[model samples]
Target: MQTVIFDLDGTLADTSGDLIAAANACFQALGHGEVLDPLADALTAFHGGRAMLTLGFERLGVDTSDVVDREFPNLLVHYEQGIDRHTVLYPGAIDAVERLRANGYAVGICTNKPEGLAELLLMRLGIRDLFGSLIGADTLPTRKPDVAPYAASVERAGGVVGKSLIIGDTVTDLNTARAAGVPCILVGFGPEGSGVARLNPDALLDHYDGLDQIVARLIGHPVLV
Candidate 1:
């Protein structure tokens, strides 16, 4: 079956509010003062947790690596508490996944989020069963920017590397897909801010609605959303 793999954070959902809350909680608990600006969340469409932490510390005129070792778990705990506080599906994401599956494409998720949390979010969003398989950071010893997860997801979808497409909002996703020798699609509206053009995916998508057209081109039959 044709396969489509998606990244969780920026590609499928807008998780910045929860992420920012967690960052603030970490700073507040440490008496580091509130550091992250709301815009930092927008910028995070590219980088994940570490990037956001680095940016927060930079804004606070502090060195992040020094505290990251201690603060990482705290931040994760804080973030998890509010995981669903404001997370939302990017526009057309649901339609895209549904239509792709209806068209006989095996859809899966390959994300760096921890497996349990990713599954929680998808289930909370009521899209858990839409995917044929889900791969998360903890699913294996290796994570994205490494090909293992992508290869595994493709295999779970009953396909090989050459027959799959990886969709995500960051360069990490593109890098992983490239590592696995698969075509990549970047979601323009996700975290990367404005430099997504440089990632050089096979296509840059602004909305999930546009995805059906892309799938149509791939399968030679229009996908119904």
Candidate 2:
């Protein structure tokens, strides 16, 4: 079976809303005025929590260490509280996963996000069972753009490097695939820390619907219906 490994955030789901709200909650706890809209904040920090916190503190002229100490925990707490409240599966993502599974493709997730939180988000999205394996940041001592995580995900999914595909939204994702020597597909709607176009992945997908064709082209097999 063709194995498709996915990145959790930005690729399969839009988690910016929840993340933004969590950051705002942290700011509120710190007694700092709200600096940005929750959704906008999440989008801006699509990279991760540290990136968001750094941006927030930089905007407020606060020390990074201070912000990390006082606000980071609050942010995590808020996120844990409503982790799934506004998070959403990207359009056509569920359909694509289901189609891939139905076509006998083994699906797995390899993400830098914490394992516990990633699992929670997937379960909340009602797509947890769709994946055969999930390798999160905490799953190993290191994460992407390290190749070990991808290699581990493939191993867990019962796939080989030549038979697996990595799908993500950032250059980091493509770099991870390169390090793993595996094929990769890029999502146009995801983070794109620099620019999605600059990454030059194996394929560019405008929507999750485009994933099916991209997979067909890469694996030379009908992995999507």
Candidate 3:
């Protein structure tokens, strides 16, 4: 089966708002009081909890991974409490996935987000059942930019590794596809906008509306089982 694996954060959904809020919770608790601006720092938010915390610490001139590590759990806790408060699926995302599935493409998710939180967010958004697999940061010993999780996601979704392509909005996603020797489709509608084009992925997605065509063009259409 052909597989279409998606990145969770800025690809399928705009999770930056809630992600920024979670990181701000950690900084607020430490008396810093909302160090990250949800709109401006959305790209950083997609980078993950640690990145947000690291940026906050950097802003305060507290340079140490140790502090970010300690506050990570706190960020996760706050995130869990309000995961979907401001998150929303990208326009046509759900429809595009459904179209892919209907056209015989196996669909799955590969996220740097922890498994539990990814699961929670998907469920909260009422889109959990859409994917055949959910491989998160902790799903394997290592995550994307390493081919392991990507392969795992394709295999778990009952698709061939040779017939897979990744749809994401970050360099991590680009690197993952490169490692797997597969096509990388980067989203151009996210915070980085046209900036992602500099990475020169296999394709740049302006919107989810015509994603299936991009997928077919890059990797060939599914066999239509």
- Per-prediction TM-score to the true structure, in the order listed: 0.91, 0.92, 0.97
The CA lDDT of each predicted structure is 0.80, 0.83, 0.93
Q: Taking the tens digit of each residue's C-alpha lDDT, what string does model 2 give over 30-52?
A: 78877667655655757888788
Model 2: runs farther than 4 Å from truth?
Answer: 191-194, 222-225
What candidate 3 gets wrong by more than 4 Å, as runs, is none
Residue 156, candidate 1: alpha-carbon lDDT: 88
Clashing pairs in 3: none
Pick by lDDT: which candidate is best? 3
Top of the candidates by TM-score: 3
Query: Model 3 Cα displacement at 33 (Å)?
Result: 1.6
Instruction: Give the local distance difference test score of model 1.
Output: 0.80
CA displacement after TM-score superposition, residue 180 of candidate 1 (Å): 1.4
Task: Kindly provide the TM-score of model 1 when superposed on the true structure, using C-alpha atoms.
Answer: 0.91
Cα lDDT tens digits for candidate 1, 133-218:
89999899999989999988888877667778888888788899778877788888866645787867888887788897775554
Where model 1 places Cα greater than 4 Å from the true spot, the runs are 218-225
